[model samples]
Target: MNAFWNRWRKQLAWESVPAGTVEGRADRDPAVGPALTDELERVLTPVMRPCAGIALAGAAESPIHSFLTGHPYLPAGTTWPEGAAGPQIFVGQINFAEVASVGALPGFPRTGLLQWFVDADDTYGLTFDRSAGTAGFSTRWYADPSTAAGSPQPDAPTPTDTVDDLPMEFVGPTALQFRHSISIPDWSGLPAQHRSDPIWERLAAALGERRADPEFVYEEYVRGGSSLLDQLRTASKVGGYPSFTQDDPRGTGSYPAADSGQAELIIELDSIDVGGWGDSGVAHLFGDPAALATGGLTSIRYHWDCL
Candidate 1:
């Protein structure tokens, strides 16, 4: 990763904006109202263009602006290059009840206010998880296709820890940046025969056919497994895996319900490595109670790096 991304990887703790802050500001401050409108237009124009029945500009009555605006936190005068195509906008669904449940995971907020920006070359996103007491930013550049094709290492070198000292300024108070050490479970420590266990077989199956290098599978599994194990630990503390009834009693089954236990697990697991195994992957792995129970895997061995 480059210096730009190195800074973004760290989750920064920022002061929370109370509910109604944005709405109140829009009502009272004229600048705030236009700024909100301008921003929504700037951010959402590209995303709505390809779809019909969506209007992004003007005094036209549209739910698009109403939904996109009123975010408590707004970007601080950041703009894409002039005349350049606008970045795509993505809004994450908010579940207030779930937000109230988890409270906060170690490095993640119980609730997240998400906004994403994507252009042809790079992707950027900002989110506030008040429950986690953090406002986080992330970016990934697609400029280097080679990086994706390169051999996956046993572990990539720790990106230089540069977020803490960057001179960049934001609209709010200076946020504190934290570096979390990546933790990987020591699968090697398992008895040679344990590799053949039913649980490992199931997990390997869930991982699907391994077209990638065998070494990459092993390394990625170890890396991704660390966070997975951590989530299971947290879930155990908060009340074990969520309960899910089989509605079909035959089909692949429904996704796990959005509950406190599941929410906390997802947050902490995602925090492990910002751009690593994504939210869907994490959810799929832990969503099933049966898979986790098979191996008696909760106390697996692991190591931590505190960079």
Candidate 2:
């Protein structure tokens, strides 16, 4: 790991971005964080993005950002989140203001509280149109949480209304901790244009300069990109590229062209201390970057899967 990564890796109370690769050893680090080498800048820097890595934190005393399995800081008079089967279990929430304090992503909101609830069904109600607000999942975002007040929603679901045979229990609070990092896109998350001739040509030029054959070099570059993604992508994060157990929901079929707009990963939760997706899977929430930059929340799409 580099000195810079080593320093912050020690400061954060919870997990952190990987310690960058040590020189003369194995090239094990994700070469695309805040610190970049001139060599890396030539190839991968264009796609790197600032992201906030997440971890469990101490109990929050107020309606600040938090991640909980059941207890939710819902203001009085608000209806408990519901799905088709019935009341949904409280998922987690993101305090954009809190994200700002931890790190910054250009389009991500700086102040707000976004929470979600899902059915305790076998798949957590993440069935159909992952883009559409399906009946199994729902989100509530307070653009201005300061103006909102009350206590935790006392009627949070006990999951007795679970739609599946497997039971879903209400776990206690899991506070949130964050650290700044950089993320590079998985090829699956790129639009058609980004993955086509233009990128390949760029890769060809970048690799061709160092090798004898551009064709052979391009293939090696692609494999290297995928290898790096697999290692650095297995943690909880917000506002960065995503790592999926199956495939990216916003892959080529979902995002055919660049003009159709780029796909943005809003939040991703690995099967960690808070909850599990299935058999050691991950949860993903995607949105439109332009919408989020302006503080829009309606673009959310939810999906989860396991290996």
> What lDDT is reached at residue 225 by model 2?
33
* lDDT of candidate 1 over 103-141, digit per residue (tens): 332332223232222221111221213211111222111
TM-score of each: 0.20, 0.68
Tell me the RMSD of model 2 versus the true structure.
Answer: 7.9
Q: What lDDT is reached at residue 293 by model 1?
A: 27
lDDT tens per residue, model 2, 1-307 = 2443344334321223333332222222333222223333445446667788887786755665566554666777777876676777777778878888976778678877778777766777866553333346887777776525746655655554444432122355567888776676656544454455344543344222344343343334443332223223336788777777786555443332323444567788877644567776888777776676566656666777788
Clashes of each: 4, 0
Off by over 4 Å in 1: 1-86, 91-104, 111-114, 120-194, 198-307
Summing lDDT over every window of 10 consecutive residues in candidate 2, give the lowest-scoring window: 20-29
Candidate lDDT (C-alpha), each: 0.23, 0.59
Report the Cα RMSD per candidate.
26.3, 7.9
- Per-residue lDDT of 127 in model 2: 66
